[model samples]
Target: MQHAIAILDSGVGGLTVVKEIMRQLPQEKIIYFGDTARSPYGPRPADEVRLFTRQIVDYLAQFAPKMIVIACNTATAVALDDIRRHVGIPVVGVIHPGARAAIKSTRSGMIGVIGTEGTIRSGAYEQALKRISPGLQVFSLACPRLAPFVERGLFGADEAEDVVRSSLEPIMNVPMDCLILGCTHYPFLADAIGQVMGPGVKLISSADETAREVSAILYHKGLLSESADIPLHQFFCSGDPALFKQIAQTWLSEQISITPVIWQVPNIV
Candidate 1:
């Protein structure tokens, strides 16, 4: 059996990263786990998020994947280094890739970052951005409501625009040239977010950059799949399978056409 790439998130938010992976590296197999029962890791305590991340990583270990991608920004901010210490395989997180993308896209040094409370509180993006370019002006906001909204599969509703507008009101007038959808889940609401942020601010999603990083790491390590045949992807969620399936199918269909195999794991909680 070919070694699969393991990706885990707090909920459907990580599907954004999965879509990018499927597009950029079609031959690679994916094993994804969504802790939908505990959908928003954003507001949780850092220690708790780290514990949940460790549990999920331990669960995915049975598959013996070649790499593990911590696709949730909240989890990435808190648990990334801990997971790396616990696992033997390569570990990737969405934070640095996102910071890198925002740096490249910004014409003005002012960049805005919106994420869950935990991500913004951790100061991870700000640190990552400053480490790359010392003089960057970074604005960070915690949009605590957005992730839960997307997790419920309501990102397409008319009310989504209103919610996005209200959530982003604080940063709307900032003269930033680009905004990082700091949470992976934010991409699900990209349409509403883009409309609110206007044309001048580029919306940078770590999904694309993270996918590129995954491909680069695999290539350098000689772990890229050599098979030409399409791979079957496995998805597992801890909450409502029907809802998770509905959102997954809707979002993934827009990117890559696939009939995903989804399972509900009740023991993770």
Candidate 2:
């Protein structure tokens, strides 16, 4: 039987990874769990983050995914190790994949990563990059408001555009060959980010690299979906159904009929 992958994130940000997975590996089925109710995990405490992440992973495991992707940067920073220890399945996080990709893309040997405060403070990306290539220089900043902007469907609005530009100003003057979209909601502001950073600096989406990693791991484990036929994908949100579906359709640029799935927190635990 073909194995499905479970993708858990604090919110819609993980869709960036999911979208890439669908495009790159058409036959693989995916179960996406978005903890919209407790999103913007960037500011939460480590223990709280870990508990929340574990709940999502445990909930998704009900589907018996061959592996799970902790797609939120904050969750990956705080809870990845816990998830790996608790779950025997291959659990992958976005940090290493993104850091590796940045290393490969940087010409100036300098890279900038922006995510929620939790992600930046954890220093996971910085540590991961050094592990991959000790010589690479990494600069990271936190953007707590970015996720909220995207979540509220304000990504392209004038205020959001201004926010993107202003937030990027600090890193713009730095000499870097590439920037990592460390947070998943970030791809939604790609145009604005690219504009501020200029075309000279390539923006690397962790989602894209993470998806590629998913392809390799599944292939190596002999767990890649066997059926040549296209697989069904499901999306569940722990928040407003109409809003989730609306934002999903806009961000994905594809129609998504997402039915609301009321996820009980304590039940998963």
The stretch of ten residues in a row with the least summed lDDT in candidate 2 is 255-264
Best by lDDT: 1
Q: To one decimal, what is the Cα RMSD in angstroms of model 1 from the true structure?
A: 1.1
Could you tell me every candidate's TM-score relative to the true structure? 0.97, 0.94
- Regions more than 4 Å wrong, model 1: 255-257
lDDT of 2 by residue, 141-203 (tens): 888878888888788788877899888878889888899998988998898899889989999
lDDT string for model 1 (1-269, tens) is: 88999999999999999999999999999999999998789889999999999999999999999999999999999999999999889999999999998888888899999999999999999999999999999999999999999988999998999999999999999999999999999989999999999999999997778998999999999999988778888999888899999999998986554667778775676
Report each candidate's C-alpha RMSD, comma-separated, in the order given.
Answer: 1.1, 2.1
TM-score of 1: 0.97
